[model samples]
Target: MKKWALFLLMFLLFILLACNDEETNEHVSSDQEEHEKPEVRTTPSESSKPKTKPLPEMTWEHLVNQEEGKLTANLDVDEKMSDQLVETLEKEITALTDETNDPEQIYRGAVDLLASSYYQTYFEKASTYDPDFEEPYLPDPEIEKKEGKKASPKKAFILLDASSSMLLRVNGKIKMDIAKNAVQRFGEVIGQDSDLSLLVYGHLGSESSEDKQLSCEGIEEVYEMSPYDEETFQASLNSFESKGWTPLAGAIKEAANMSRDFTEDVTVYVVSDGVETCGGDPVAAAEAFTKDSKERKVHIIGFHVDETAENELKKVSDAGNGTYYPADNEEELQDTIQKRWLPSLADLAWAHTKAPGPWEVLGKLEELEKHTNKLTEVRQLETERLNTVYRLIRDHDLLSSEAREDLKALLDERDDEIRTLIKNLTDEKKEDINKQADDIKNRVSEWRDRMYELRDEERDHS
Candidate 1:
């Protein structure tokens, strides 16, 4: 009986162990299947994607906001003006100012404001001035055939001033240093197909009377007129120091002589801090150069100079039939070189290929006329506004008798400034518009005659 009971217990234990082993095997198989399975990703439908909004258009107000502090800093508005009046003017004028309250920006803003306010009115008036006037259609001029070998590249003469005045500091930087940096940047950007010559003056001796003669004769063509070499140009720039009298006339004469040999157009750039200090007639020199070669233009840059010096330099540029740019800081220097000189150089280089047609010239003239008229209107409006403000202050009894007198004096000064500004704007507009119109009219007449000639030739042939 005991043996039978022990056998039953062993059978029961063996059955239980077998069942546990089977359960463990099934669990391991399930986990292995899960690990071996591949991942399946489902993409979202097209309708589920987010939409992107279009960018906002940039406006004058946007520009003002971007350069708020700098634009508003130089505004000449009086603190005693009524808050409402001030606010209105600020809103109107802020759009007219930019990051740099430079003269160029102010003039440009004034023109733009005028255009926005009075372009249509003037344009209509101009259209009625000549009802029978037909706009000209000008085709591109034919490229002149080049004989066997190609012509030499156009030449650019860069006259860098290294006078004692250039050593003075402007915005914490020496004017010479600023000029050097600007020229270096310009050199880097100028096209490789053009030849550049760098002539430096006023770098030989001290500012003493004994050294004046030596400095006056120190004009050196450090970089010869050839394909631009960055290393050589930089080395030449490093060799000079600002320590002598300005020999501007001598430099211009030498540059003009050097450019006389070139068949293509030549551009002369005189970077100076002041007029000729060595008692040379720079204006005459420029005039002679321009008269000698109609293809040559001399641009003068007054670097950190006073009004008197600026006016003196302007004479040289005017005589040379070129633009006079005044640069008070590094920013202005860069702007003048990049926007004015560089583009002019490019145009001269590609004149035969890309000169504006009669149609383009005519369109530009029309635009200039519209701008001029608008500027006139703007000046008138501004004057009226100023007078209204003055009257309002007086009528409101905004100050005591003594204070009123002082305010009146201030207003009178402001009025004088406005009148001067208006006069300048008017003169500039008249000169620019009249010159552009004359040029366009001549070109249009020539184009029309050419068209008629071509039509006659075709008819004869047919």
Candidate 2:
């Protein structure tokens, strides 16, 4: 009777040990079910339920100009960077989880690691990176706006709305102060050979009905219509404050009047935080500016605006045959001013230079393609780094066979995601490049026709 009892006790103990060793795995949703919440994981075995530490952080930054769209990545596997990736992964396994460790937990972490917000940082900064690196960056290579030494550089007539709304603080700084910095920085850039004229509206009176007439009629060229002079521009920027109502229509009309006599093409940039509170038709005024001067282009930057104000600003830009840029911060504001088409065609001496516009534009496109090529290297490098870390862990038997396989799958999945992002972004940028190229081609064609007409008239008169 005693021996039978002992045998039964040993059998029960054996069953208990077996049950404890049966590890449960965590399940992550595949691509098709990505949006759905991850299903609850089975109860992990005592040996598999290890304490997890937070994952390592990864970031991508611009190694070049945003217009170049170049991103930095370590393809050859930097030991320091890889080491951080490994330590985070190591915490997910337990003392008893050796060669028999299941893959589910490690995989879930891998999915989170790939979806890290750091990956999206590139896009955030890329917005200011020159989304519409328009006609000025490289210019329409064929048309020349600067014809002689006496000819002035293309004019950049910048309009500022000094309505009381601009006094609102953002990130601890007043919006007017921020705009001042952006405008000054924009004026400081040389070699573009563009003269900058600073204009401000609604800077004269308070936002009271008694002062409404004063504010609405207030439009002043604080910075004279001259080449960018840092000291003078600074003084001009200091001359205004966020004091009154928004006279958007009056501002546009004033800009048109200022540039009416400019023989070369002109670009007008209006920076405002609100719409036309003065009850004027801003869109029509912009349209008239473009109509009166064929070479004039109008652009608007909505600074810290709501949806309604943005919509109205868009209409103004559209009517003026220009684009609308929204800037919530100083960096974006500066980028909006500096990054649109550089002094390309306007700076090119027109005295003896002319080329087929489309070909020149295509040539510039190649430079962009070369810049984008750097993205392909990101996939190859990240995959290699993951494989290296995996092999190191596998050879040392850090995780069970199943976990190793799952990690490999996770690595592959992450690599695919990075590739897809690169492809999509590249395609979008290429489309934009094509559109800008078409625009340049149109401008060049128009200029050629105008020149021919002028030449024929000269001959007829002679």
TM-score, structure 2 vs. true: 0.42
lDDT of 2 by residue, 1-462 (tens): 999999999999999887666532112325346667578857678886777554333223421222211111321322224465555445433322442354545444333332222233344443223333323222221232232112223788889889999999989889998888776766655224677888899898899999999999999999887777767888889877889999999998998887777787787888899999999999999999999665677888899899999999999999988889899887677656544222323433341233335556566556555545545554455466456546766877777676688778867766776677667666777677677666655665665555455556657989
Highest lDDT model number: 2
Candidate 1 residue-wise lDDT, 186-290, digit = tens = 665453446899999999998999999999999999988878787988888998899999999999999887876678778788899998999999999999888
Alpha-carbon TM-score of each model against the true structure: 0.41, 0.42
lDDT (0 to 1) per candidate: 0.65, 0.66
Give the clashing residue pairs of candidate 1, or none. Answer: none
